[model samples]
Target: MVTKVVLNGVAIQAEEFEEEVIRQNGVPLHKIRFAFKVRSNEYHDIATLLYEKTFDVSVPEKDLNFRGTIQNYSTSVTNLYKENEVADYRLELVETN
Candidate 1:
């Protein structure tokens, strides 16, 4: 139930957050999914950050930090180039091995 997530040093207010530990070949990995909103003014910065693919992910409430890559991503609005627009974004990140 993490309420905030820090990605590459940028703090994001998460509307929803979920974390899971999954084992692959008996090795544990952290996977997190979170949702947030992006305003028109923030679209550029958020897009640039996500486009980087990999991140230093942090969840203070969970005391979690890891170098992760994007596992899934989605946005509610595709046309966020205009002013006064807001988009809902969902992202999933998995810890790098």
Candidate 2:
């Protein structure tokens, strides 16, 4: 379970997390992409903050902690009358130069 995405001193309560490494010619690269989400009521407050073109981002999880910048982001709302309480987000980031 994802806990939060911290950026620029603000923490966003996230519900999901995904991390991927980009490689070229079987060699490792310094760039990384991360996706995270926020469910329930806090979605509206923190949704916009995750999409900054360039900002310090920190993802502290049970297994690993990633810190980088906001390369990109997208959000999805369940919108179901019964399950209208969920917000999903996907984020991309690259290592700071």
Candidate 3:
């Protein structure tokens, strides 16, 4: 399965991404959240954009079937911007069948 999520104009690879499972109907539902670090101070504006933007997730291939939703999201800005620090986030992917 190929899962792709884009946040703040930055596209993230969702492969091997961390997922939290919530069970329903004896089935495992997954909630996946990704944290990405910002490398440049110029990303501040883009970081702010995170508050207003909704991510686009693409699953080109899926052997196992599931449904997805945006459960929650938030963002953070540093006092003094630095590289390799988290700037913002998209959403928590809630997967259900």
Candidate 4:
């Protein structure tokens, strides 16, 4: 089981994680979905990092690494801009072809 995942150069502890293989037009791709928390103070940096939509993904516990694109993303709170607020974030990524 993957307990942590690295995006770009930032490492985040996973609250929930899932990995699977999916075939698209006979090509197998690696897809991962995970959940984690984001704090108000860290929101700006995270947003900036994700703005590119693609980054290096690494799961050290599984010895896996790849370049991936964001397929889906969501956050539980809209008020993360407030000081001291924390929000739950869910992200999905798929390996680039």
Candidate 5:
């Protein structure tokens, strides 16, 4: 299990992030989701992670550290501009090695 997400040099809070491994189109990838309440004004500079295209992920429980590229980016728009948006940030990372 992923215990922390460190992008650049910032440590994103665990409460706002979720991590898992899953197969998409028969390819294995690390899936990370960021679900922050609309109230928290903390922007972890998600754009940088997307633009940089790579990050170091820590799975503390497993004592693993690896770097991967952002293979996919997506968001969930509950109602577009008409309503509050939630669950709207996600990333799919494929290990280069």
Candidate 6:
């Protein structure tokens, strides 16, 4: 038996800042770095939220068959903020009979 979990369309939130430092020639240098953190709905939380949906494998007739075959499934998060607007995730199940 196999189970898979995926997270999609995660957003990155951060800010840009600059710092001044003295160089070898006594000249001031400016350095910049983008500081940010990843923000998104937690995968576990999303999975739990999906409980209300029809994601149950046992409910599907094809899932009950353990014959040699591969099953492909997918889910996605459509609405994301900033750079994480759209993403898709796929899962594959292989049965060894």
Top-TM-score candidate index: 1
- Please report the TM-score between candidate 3 and the true structure: 0.43
lDDT of 4 at 33: 92
Ranking by TM-score: 1, 4, 5, 2, 3, 6
Per-candidate TM-score against the hidden true structure: 0.94, 0.51, 0.43, 0.92, 0.52, 0.22
Stretches off by above 4 angstroms in model 2 are: 1-4, 13-30, 60-67, 78-84
Task: Give candidate 5 misplaced runs (Cα > 4 Å).
Answer: 14-40, 77-87
Which lDDT tens digits does candidate 3 get at residues 1-97? 3365554345555434555678878888766776554446646665565545344344334322245656776546644266655455445666636
Candidate 3, superposed: residue stretches over 4 Å from native:
1-10, 13-16, 37-65, 77-86
Query: Residue-wise lDDT of candidate 1 within 1-97, one digit each (tens)?
Result: 3388999999999978989998878889999998999999999999999999999999998899999999999999987899999999999999999
Query: How far in Å is the alpha carbon of 18 misplaced in model 3?
Result: 1.4
Worst 10 residues of 2 by lDDT: 78-87
lDDT, candidate 6, 11-59, per-residue tens: 2222342122325356443222223222244444444433433222221
Candidate 2 lDDT at 7 equals 68
Pairs that collide, model 6: none
In model 5, the worst 10-residue window by lDDT is 35-44
Q: Estimate the lDDT of model 2.
A: 0.57
Model 5 global lDDT (CA atoms, 0 to 1): 0.55
**Inter-residue clash pairs, candidate 3:** none
Model 1, position 23: C-alpha lDDT score: 86
Worst lDDT run of 10 residues, candidate 3, spans 56-65
